[model samples]
Target: MRRYGPAVLLLLTGAAILRVALFTELYLRYVQAGLRPYLVGSGFLLVLLGVAAAAVGRREREPHGEHDGHHGPRIAWLLALPALALLLFPPPALGSYSAAREAEQRAAQGIGSFPALPAGDPQALTLAEFSSRAVYDSGRSLTGRTVRLTGFVTRDDDGTWYVTRLLVSCCAADATTSKVEIREADAPPADAWVTVTGIWHPKGRLGTDGAWPPVLDAASVRRVAQPANPYERR
Candidate 1:
C-alpha cells in the first residue's frame, strides 16, 4: 500500500474532479462554464497516469535498501482526504455568508445612456445589469420598467436586506458582489434563492456614493430553485 500511495492519491484526486466536472453540474459552483473541458481533460489524464503508476509499482520487487520502508512522506497521504470528501459530498455554491462578508465595490463606469429596454411588462435582468442601470444610467432607462431579478438573500447588521448575486471573471476565487436593496416587501430567508419583480426605487443621484446598492420596490418575491451557474460572468 505504501508503494502505491502516489497512485492512490492521484486516482482519488482525478475521481473527485470527474465527479464534479463530468458526472454533474457541481463544477459550476467553483469555476466558469468555459473551464469544464479543461477540467475534464486534466482529470482524465490524471486517472490514466495513476493507473500507469500503479501498474509499474506492482511489477517492482520489494526494495531492501536504506529507503526500504519509506514510500515518500506519510503526511502526504493527508492530501487525499480532501479529494475523497469532494468525491463523496461536493460543497454548495457560495451564498449569503460569502456575500455578507464582501465590501461593496462596483467597477467604475462613466454615467451614460443605456439602450432602451425591450418592450415588456416585466423584463428579466441580471443583478449586475440592474445595478449598473440604476446607479449609472443617465437616461434613466429603468424609470418605468418593471424588472425581474434573481439572487440569493443577504442582510446587513442594520437589518437591511439585499437580493445579491456574485459576479466572477474567471472563477469563485475572484467573485464580486452585485446587490440591490429590496423594499416594500419582507426579505426571504438568508441565502434563499428568490425572484424579485419590482420597479426601480431610486435613491440619491446617479453615479454618486449615495446611489450605491440601487433600490427596488418589489411587487412580488417568489422562491425559486438555485441556478446551476450561480455566478454571473463579469
Candidate 2:
C-alpha cells in the first residue's frame, strides 16, 4: 500500500483535474448561482474518504512488514470506473444537438441576423477563407455573396441537405458540426463529399426540430472525395 500510494494519489489528482477542466463552464455557472454550498458539503465527504483510505493503507503497510516498494492490492483498477462512465455515457457530438440548441437560443434572443455585404470581386475568395472570415464577423462579410464550400453531405429530418464541417477540440469525441444548406439544382446524397456554390442568405423560419438555420442558396453541388482531415480547425 505504501509503495503504490504515490501512484494512486497522482492518478486521483490527474483524474480530478481532467474532470474539472472538462466541465469548467458548468462549474462556473453553478458557482455563480450560490449552489456551491452543496458542492462544499459533498467535497468534504470525499476528502474524509481519501484521508481514511490513506490512514488504513498506512496501518496495513506496517503489519505486513512490507518495504516501501512492495506491491499493494491492485487499486489501480479502480481508476477505470471514471473512464468507463465517460465511454458509456459519452456527450453528444456537436451536430444536430448543438445546432438545435443554438437555433432555439437565437430565436429567443432575436440574434444572428447579418448585415448586407458590400459589392466586391467575389471570385477572389475560397470557401474555407470565407467560412473563417464569417466566424469572426458572420453578418457583414458573408451576406449577399455567392461562395463555394466543399464538405460531406449531411441531412436534417425535413429532407433538406447541407454541406457539413466538423470542428473538433481533439478527436471525434468532442467534435462540433456546422453546416451550409444546399439549394442547387443538383444536391448530393448524404455523406457524399461535394462542392457547393451558393449565394449566402439567412434562414427564413425555424424548422420543427430547430436546426441552426442554413445560410446558402446553392447554385451547384458536385460530388468529391472526403478531405484527409475531415474536422475543421480546433
* Residue 130 of model 1, lDDT score: 95
The alpha-carbon deviation from the true structure for residue 93 of candidate 2, after best TM-score superposition, in angstroms, is 13
Say which candidate scores most in TM-score.
1
Best by lDDT: 1
Q: Model 2, 143-226: lDDT tens per residue?
A: 666677776766778878777766544445544556666664555666677877767665443332323445677776777866
For model 2, the superposed segments whose C-alpha errors exceed 4 Å read 1-139, 204-211
Worst 10 residues of 1 by lDDT: 63-72
Candidate 1 residue-wise lDDT at 63: 53
TM-scores, all models, native as reference: 0.95, 0.43
Candidate 2 lDDT (Cα, 0 to 1): 0.52
